[model samples]
Target: MIAREWKCRVPEAHAEGFTAYLYETGVRDSSATPGFLGAQIFRRPLIGKIELTLVTYWKSLDSIKAFAGEDISRARLYPEDEVYELEPDVDVQHYEVIEHGFIPGGL
Candidate 1:
């Protein structure tokens, strides 16, 4: 499994709306993609900024490339994202998931 993460900082006032937009767009689209396993969003509120991390799981790098294009490390952006005043990282990080497990029906 491949773990991919992208980070960005948003103005406090716009953080909530931006998170919603991400879920409605990126997360939603990713969920429907082939080889996409899961996605999670993490957030930390700073004094005047909100730090957000979008994490996604993929079956392989090739799957990621299908979603992110030839340069899989590059961050993907939408035109509407400018409204949130996001300062996004230029590249995303990917890691090889060494170990992970979940109990069936635990939720």
Candidate 2:
């Protein structure tokens, strides 16, 4: 499996709204694409801004290309992003999933 990671920052006040928007955009769009394995969204509270990271799992690079187009390194953005004062990364990172599993009794 392959993992594609993207990150962005938004003001603390916009965190909630942005999260919902993400689900509607990135998450929903990726979920519908073929070869999309799964996705995880993470948020960290900073001093005054919130950092959000999205890690999407895919079956292969070709599968990713189907979703991200020819340039898989670029981060996909939605038109509504500016409404949340989003500070987004222009590029995304890709990695090969070497090991993955859940520990028993661990959340």
Candidate 3:
């Protein structure tokens, strides 16, 4: 399994909008791709900014490349991202998942 993570900071005032955009774009799009296991979004407030981290699970690097294109290390960006992200990283980090478990909802 492959775990991909991207990090960024946005102003506190823009946090909600940025998060919504992330869900609308990354989460929605990734869910539609084959081999996309799932996605998680994390956030925390620091000073006057909000730090956002997006983690996505994939069955393999090839799956990620399908969604991310030829240069898989580069972070995917949308047109409106320029207004929300404050100094977002240009690249994403990928790791091999040793083990993972999740409980489905409706339990």
Top-TM-score candidate index: 2
RMSD of each: 1.9, 1.1, 2.2
Weakest lDDT window of 10 consecutive positions for candidate 2: 71-80
Best lDDT among the predictions, by candidate number:
2
Candidate 2 local lDDT, 30-98, one digit each (tens): 999999999999999998999999999999999999998999999889898999999999999999999
Q: What lDDT is obtained when candidate 2 is compared to the true structure?
A: 0.97
Candidate 1 Cα misplacement greater than 4 A, ranges: 102-107
Better of 2 and 3 by lDDT: 2
TM-score to true structure, per model? 0.91, 0.96, 0.91
Please list all clashing residue pairs in model 2, or write none if there are none. Answer: none
What ranges in model 2 sit over 4 Å off? Answer: 104-107
lDDT of each: 0.92, 0.97, 0.91
- Compared with the true structure, model 2 gives a TM-score of 0.96
Write candidate 1's Cα lDDT for 3-106 as tens digits: 99999999999998999999988898878889999988999988899999999999999989888899988998888988999899979999999998889999
